[model samples]
Target: MLSFTPYENPTYFGILAIALLPIVIGLLCKKRFHWYETIISIFFLVLTFGGPKLTQGYALIAYLIYEVVLVWLYTSYRKHKNQTSIFVGAVILAIIPLVIVKLTPAIQNGQQSLIGFLGISYLTFKAVQTIMESRDGVLKAFNPWFFLQFLVFFPTISSGPIDRYRRFKKDYDHVPDTDKYLQLLQKGVHNIFMGFVYKYMLAYLFGTLLLPKLQQQALSAHGLSWSLVGVMYVYSMYLFFDFAGYSLFAVGTSYFMGIETPINFNAPFKSHNIKEFWNRWHMTLSFWFRDYIYMRLVFFFMKHKVFKSPKTTANITYIINMTIMGFWHGVTWYYVTYGILHGIALVVNDWWLRYKKKHQKQIPHNKFTEIFAVFVTFNFVCFTFLLFSGFLNTMLLAK
Candidate 1:
C-alpha cells in the first residue's frame, strides 16, 4: 500500500493538490460538500496512519473512541451538575493515555507505548481543552459527530496548530462567500509556496545537508567547540523552518477548505526577550499553555493564598508549567533541562522588565539596545535548542 505522512514532501503535496481540487472548487462555488470533505479526510487519514503504520491507525481509532465518549459524558454531566472532583477526574482520564505514552520510553528502555499514535499529544490537548471549556460553560453543546470531525480533521491530524472547539466549529459550520473564499485562496497559495521554500529548500539545506556534517564535527571535537556552536545555530534554523513550514502547510490547507486556522509562527528569531520569543515561536502551544496551565495555576494559587506575593506565585508557576511542557516532549533529562532553562529565562525576563520599568532613565532604550537584546535572546534560545537536541548526551555520555 502507498502512504505518505502529511506534507512530508513535494510529492505528498502533489497528491494533496489533486485531492483538494474538488473541495476548493466547491468552496469557490459557495458550497461545502460535507460528504466529499469527509471522504477526503478518511482518504488522507488512511494515507497518514494506514499501510505499514497500521498499528498507529488502530491506536488513533481506539483513542478517538475513548476520547469522544469521555468528552460526551463530561459534557452531559456538566449540563446539570458541576462538580470539581468529577471534572478533575475527567481531565485525568483524558490525559492518562498520553501520560503512559510519555513515560513508556523511560520505563521500558526507550520502547514506545502500544497506545501511542502520531499526534496523540495534540489530540489530548484538544480533548482536555474541550472538557475544560465545557466545565467553564464556554462550550455548551457537544455533538459527538462534529467532535469526531474536529478531532480527525486531516490537515492537522498528524500535528497541529491546535484549533479550539468553538473556533473550529464556527468555521466548519459556515461556508464563506465567493469573494471571501477568493481571499482565502490567495493567502493559501502564498502560504503553500512559502512553505515549499522553508521546508523543501531551507530546511533541507540546514537539516539534511549541513546538520549531519556539523553533528559529525561537533561529536568528534566533543565538549565546547566551535563545531558545537555551528550545530546549535544550524539545528535551530532547521527546527524553525521545518516546523514553521509544516504549520504553514497545515494552515494553508485549512484555508483551502475555507477554515482560517491559527498560525503557529511569527518571526520568532527576531524576538527580543524570552517572553516575547514564546509569543512568536510555536505560538499555539505557548498560548495554550498560558491560557490553560499558567493562568489556571495563578488563579488556583491566588484563590488558595498559596504565596505571600504575586511575583513569587508567578515565578514558581512559570517554572512548573515549563517543566511540565518539557516533560511532555519526552521523559528525558535533556528535555526536562531544556524546559527548566526556559522557565528560569522567563523568570529573569520578567524581573528585567520590572527593573527596566522602574529605572527607565538609567536603562538605555535605543536601536542598538534593541539589536543587542535580539542578539542575546536569539543566542540564548539557540543554546537551549542545543540542549533540546540531545547532542550533548550523545557526545558526552554515549560509549
Candidate 2:
C-alpha cells in the first residue's frame, strides 16, 4: 500500500489532479456528486494515514468519534442549559487529547504519543470553536454526520487554514453556479501553480539544500557568527515559502471543492509592524487566537476589573495569549520564549502607534519611513524566527 503526505511533491499533485477531475466536472455542470466526493475523501485519507502510518489512521478515527460525540452532547446541553463551568469543562475535554499529544514528547524523552494524529491541533480548534459558538447560540444545530464531514474535510485536514463549521456547511450543502465555479477553478489552478513555485522550487532550494549547509556552518562555528546570521535569514524565507505554499495548496484544494476556505497568508513579509505581520501571517490561526483566546481574556479581565487600566490589561493578555500559543507549538523553552517575544513586540508596536498618533505633526510619515518600517519589521521577525528555530538550543545546550 502506497502512502503519501498531502502535497508532499509534484507526483502527489498529479494524483490529486486525477482524483479531483470528476468533482470538477460535476461542479462545472452545476451539480455536486456527493458520493464521488466521499469516495475521494476516503481514498486520500487512507493515503495519508495508511501503510506505515496506520496507527495514526486508527487514532484519527477514534479521535473523530470522540469529538463528534463530545460536541453532540455539549450542543444538546447548551440548548437547555448554559453554564460557564460546564462549557469550560466541555472545551477542556475536547482539548485533553491535544494537550496530551503536546506534552508526551517533553515528558517521555521526545517520544510521540500513540494517540497523536496529523492535524489534531487544527481539528481540536474547530471542535472547541463550535462548542463555544453553540453555547453562544450562533451554531443552533449539530448534525453528527455533517460534523464528521467538516472535521474530515481532506483539503485542510492535515494542516488547516481552519474553516468554521457554518461557513463550511454553507459551501458543502450548495453547488456553485457555472460561472462561479469557473472562477474558482481559475483561482484554484493559479494557487496550485504558485504553491508549486513556493514549495517545490524555492522551499526545496532553501530548506532542503541551503538550510542544511547553513546549519552545518553555523553549528561548526559553535557561537554567534555571520554563518548563524545567514542561517537566520535563510531559514525565515524557507519557513515562509514552505508554509505559505502549503497553505495555498490547502485553500486551492478547498476552492476546487467549492468551499471558500480562508487564505492563510497575505504578503506577511511585507507587513509594516509586528501587529500587521500577525494580521497577514498564518492569518486564520492568528485570527483564531485573537478571537478565541486574546479577546476572551481581555473581556474577562475587564468584566472582573482585573486591571486598573485597559492598556495594562491588553499588554498582559498579549503576553499570556502568545505564551499559550507558543506552548501549543510545543512544550519547550524556545517556543515559549518565541511567544513572549512576539507578545512584547505587539505591546511595543501598539505603544509606538499611539505615540505616533499623538505626535503626528512632529513625526514624519512618508515613503522612506514606510520602507524603513517594513525593513525593520521584516528583520525583527526574522530574528524571532531564529529563536523559534531551536538551532540556538542545539548550539548552546548540546555538550
Candidate 3:
C-alpha cells in the first residue's frame, strides 16, 4: 500500500530534486515557470515514485487515455454545436468504471488492493468535475496539455482541494511574477517540512505506538468503551494531519507554478459546529457538493415534494445530500454510518441555527461556550472517523 509517509523514500526525494531543476533553470534563463511547466515536472516526480503497482499503473494509463478522449470530445463539441449533449453523455458514461471500482469491494481487498491504485477516488472526482464544467460552459477554452496537467497534477492528485475548472483557467492564464515565485518557493519549503512533521512525527507516533497499544488493550480487556474513544481522538488528528499536509504540499506546488489553487483546510478542528467544520475543512470538496450536488438535490426534492412543504423539507434534502456526499468518501458500512451520523449532526445544527435566530437572547456566546462547542464538534468528527477506521471491523465481525 502506498503510505502517506513523508520523505523516507530516496526515490521521492530524487524526483523532487528533478522537478526543482526546471524551476532553477527557468529562473536562470529569466523565464518564469508557467503552471503547465510545473505540472509536467510534478508528473515526472510522481511517476518516478509510482514504481510498480499494476492496478495503479493501469489506472493511470486509463486516465491518460480518458483525458485524450475527453479533450477530443470537448474539441468536437466546440467545432460542432449539435454534439454538445452527446459530449455530456460521453463524459457521464466515462465515469461508470470508476463508480463500479469504488462501489465494489472485492477489487480493493487481499492482494487486489495492493495493485488497486492510490487516490483513484480523488482523480475520478477531478476528471468528472472538469468534464461536467466543460459541458456546462464554465471552461471557455480547452488546451489538451493543460487539461492533462490538471487531470494528473501530482501533489493534489492523491488528495485534492478539488480545483474548479473556471478558477484553474483563470490561474493558468496568468504567468508567475519573480517575487511571487520566491514567495511560493519559500512556502513550498515550509509546507514540505510541515508535511514531514505531520506525517512522520504526529501521525506516526499515534499510528505506530498509541493506536496499536490502545487496540491491544481494548482487545485484551474484552471492552472498547475507553479505548474506542481514545482511538477516535488519535485517528481524527492523524487524518487531519495526513490530509492537510498533502493539501499544503499541493497548494504550495501550485503556487510555485503560479497557479493559485484554493485552500482545502482552514483549521477545521476549531470549527464551532458541523456546518462550520464542513465549510472550513475540505473547503473545495464541500463547495463541489454544495454547488453541483446539494443545492440541485434540494431544489429537485422541493419541486417534487408530496406537499408544498416548509423550509424543513428543503433542509432535510440538504441533510440527505450531505449524507450521500459522506457515503461517496468510501465503500463500507462504516462509511454509511459516518454519513448518516454527520447528516444527523447537520440537521440538529440547522435546528439550532433556526432556534437561535428566533430567540436571540437564549444561546450562550461566551468564550468557554465557544470553546465547548468547538470541542464537541471536533470530537463528533473524530468518533465518525474511528467508526470508519478498519479497526472497528474486528469487533463487528466477532459479534
Candidate 4:
C-alpha cells in the first residue's frame, strides 16, 4: 500500500472519499457504525504508516501500546488510591518518551531518535492530560480501548487541533441527528474546499513561489533591509495559510465523521495583542497550554506562596509557560527564544491592559487605535516567526 500524509495531495483525499463514503451515508441514516469506522481508521492509518513510511507505522504501534498500557495501569491505580507523588510520576512517565525524542536531535548532532515518530508530541500532550485529569478525579472511567481510539484519531493525528478525552468520547459515543449530520456535511465540504484554496492556491503562491525568492534576496542583502522585511511578512503569511489550511482539513474531516474537532486558527493575524493572538492562533494548543501548563503553574505558585504579589507570580509563570511552549517546538535556541519573546510580549500586554484599565480616560480607544494594535501585533508576531523559521541562523552562518 502507498503511504499518504493527511491532506498532502488531492489523490489522498480521493482515497479518503472512498473510505469515508459509507460512514457518511451511515451517519445520514442516523446509524453509527463503530466497526466500519474502525476499519476505515485502520485503512487510513496504513495508508499513512504503510509502504515507505513503515518505520513510523511501527513506531506508532509501539507508542500506542505503551501509552494504552500506561494509562490503563494509572487509571487502575488511581481508582484505588490518591497520591501526589505517584500521580506526578505517572505524568512524568507519560512524557519521558516525548522528552527523549525531543532531546535526541539536540544531543546527537541533529540525528533523530528511534522512538520518534510523526504526531508524537500531540500524542504525548493527550496522554499527559489524561493522566492529569485522572489525578484530579475528573476522568473516572478510563476505557483503554476508547482512549486508544481518541489518541490515534487519524484526522487530527498528524498535526492537531487536539481534542480532550471526555469531549471526544461524548461525540464518539453517539450519532448526530439527520439535520445536524446534513449541516456537518455542508460544513465539511466547505472547509475542505476552503482548505484546498489555502493549502494549494494561497500557500503555493506564498510558500512555494514567493518565499524562496524573498529568502534569497534577504540573504543576499547580508543583513536587515527591505528584502528582509518582505521575507518576514511573506513567511508569516505563508506560515499561517499553510498551517491554517492543514487545520481546516483536520477539523473538516472530523466534522464529516460526526466529531466536532476544535479549530486551530481563527484569523490570528487580526488579533489586537499577543494575548488575543494566542486565543486565536493554534487555539487548541494554546488553550491546552493555558489550561494545563499556564494555569497549573499559576495555581502552584499561589498555593506555595512562591511570590507575595499576584502580578509577580503571573509574570514569572508567563515566561515559564511560553518558554516551555518554545522548547516544545524544538530544543534549538531560536525556538526557545521565540517562546521567550512571546512570553515577554504577553507580560507587557497584560501590564498595558491593566494600566489602561486604571487610566481609561487617558488612553484613547478608537478605530485608529484598534487598527494600530492589530498592526503592531501582526508585525511582532511576524518578527518572531522570522526567528522561528531559522532563516536568521542560516543568514548568520552565511555572513
Q: Whose lDDT is greatest here?
A: 1
- Relative to the true structure, candidate 4 reaches a TM of 0.99
Q: TM-score of every model? A: 0.99, 0.98, 0.86, 0.99
The residue-level lDDT of candidate 4 at 86 comes to 90
lDDT of 3 at 188: 70
Alpha carbon lDDT at 397, candidate 1: 78
Residue range 15-51, candidate 1, lDDT tens digits: 8999899999888887899999899999988888878
Instruction: Report the lDDT tens digits of candidate 2 across residue range 169-223.
Output: 9999999999999899899989988998999899989999999999899888888
lDDT scores of the candidates, listed in order? 0.94, 0.93, 0.70, 0.93
lDDT of 4 by residue, 96-145 (tens): 99999999999999999988888999999999999989988999999999
Off by over 4 Å in 4: none
| lDDT score of residue 173 within candidate 2 | 95
User: What digit string (tens of lDDT, one per residue) describes model 3 on residues 1-399?
Assistant: 342222446566566667767765575454656664756655653463454544466766676677567655765575447365676676666666566665666454622333235656666676667666666666667677777767666656666768866677666666566776677678777776787787777878877778888877666666667887787788787788777777776777666565677888888998999999999988988888787677766766777783476567766766687677766766667877888888788889988888988897877678998899998998888878888786687766755
Counted clashes in each candidate structure? 0, 0, 0, 0
User: What's model 4's lDDT at 261?
Assistant: 94
RMSD of 3: 3.5
